[model samples]
Target: MGHINNKYYLGFEGEPEIIFTVVQKNNEKSEISIWSGYFNNIMQQITPVEGKWTALAYYYNLNIGWYDESPWLVDNIEDAYKQFKSIDKYKLDDLEEEILEEILELFKKSIEENNNVYISYE
Candidate 1:
C-alpha cells in the first residue's frame, strides 16, 4: 500500500500559509522536486466568501504561453492585489486601511517595474 504525505503550517490569518511539499510513495520510490517558498506572503488574509476574494493564484508565469501576451505584468505585492481585485471584484475592507494602502502602493511599484507577482489562496 502507498500513501500521500503532505504537511503545512497555519499563518496568522488561520490559513495554510505554507505547503511544504507533496510526496508520493510506490514500489519504485522517487521524490518530486518542489520549490519551497513558492507561495510566501503572496496572499492577503481575506475570506473568499465574504471579502470578495477568490481561491485562485493571481500571478501567471511570463515564461508560459498566453501570459506573454500582456507586456505589463504585476511583479510586486501591491500590483498583485490590484490584479486580484480585477479578477475577483472583491474589496479588502476587512483588512486595515493602512495595510490595503501599502499593498496598493507596492502593486503600483511592481507594475512600473514590470515585475510578475503572484498570490495563492489559503
Candidate 2:
C-alpha cells in the first residue's frame, strides 16, 4: 500500500524535523504505519491541510510563469502547526495525546528555525 511521507528542509538538504515516520527492511526510512489513528471522532477530522491548497498553488504557478508545475509554497506552514496544536486534550487517550504532543514538538522546532515541511505520497 502507498503511504504519505513528509520531509523538512532547513532551506537546505539537511535533516528535517520529522513528525510521522517508519522504517523499511533495508533500514531505510520509509512510510506505512497502520497504527496511525485512534478512534476519537475529532482525531479523524484532524489534519494539517489548507482548504484552498490547489488554488494557492495554481496562483503561485502563474506568478512564477510556470503552468505545468504547481508547488504549494511553504509560507503557510503556520497553519499546519496550528492544526496540530488545536487538538482537544480531554477526548484523547493518554497515548494519543502523547503522540500529538511529540509531533507538535517537531512542528515547534521547525517553525522556530524557519524550515519548510514537505509532504508527499511516495
Candidate 3:
C-alpha cells in the first residue's frame, strides 16, 4: 500500500496565519515529516508545487498585509523596534476590520468549491 500523505490547516480566524505539513512514506514501515511554515500574507504563500509533493495553505484575513507595512518592514528585530518608536500610534489603529471579514469569506468559498478534490488525512 502507498503511504498516507496529508495536509491540515490549524487556524482559520483572527489573523492570516498558516501551517503546512507534508508527510512522505520513506518505506513500508515508516513515514517522514517534511516542510512546514507559517505565512502572514496571501501573495507570499502562493506558489506552484513541484515533484512528488503537494501543497496546502490555510490563513485568516486580518493579517494579510500586517507585516508588509512600515515600521514592520525592518530588516531585523532591532530595526523594527527603532522604526516602531517613530511611528504614529493612531495611524496603526485605522485598519478596517470589514476587509478582513471579506477575505475570510473568499477563502471559505474557495475551500468549499474545491472540497471534492481534497484527500483527508484524518
Candidate 2 residue 93 Cα shift, in angstroms, is 0.6
TM-score of each: 0.30, 0.44, 0.20
From the highest TM-score down, the ranking of the candidates is 2, 1, 3
The 10-residue segment of model 1 with minimum total lDDT is 29-38
User: Of the candidates numbered 1 and 3, which has the greater TM-score value?
Assistant: 1
Estimate, for each residue in 1-122, the C-alpha lDDT of model 3 and write its tens digit.
Answer: 43332221234333333222221233222121111222223223233335221222211123322233311211222322222233333332222222223333333443444311111111
lDDT of 1: 0.33
Ranking by lDDT: 2, 1, 3
lDDT of 2 by residue, 15-40 (tens): 22222332233434433111322312
How many clashes in each candidate?
6, 0, 0
Identify the superior model by lDDT, candidate 1 or candidate 2.
2
Using alpha carbons, what is the TM-score of model 3? 0.20
Provide the RMSD of all predictions against the true structure, rounded to 1 decimal. 14.0, 12.0, 18.0
The prediction achieving the highest TM-score against the true structure is: 2
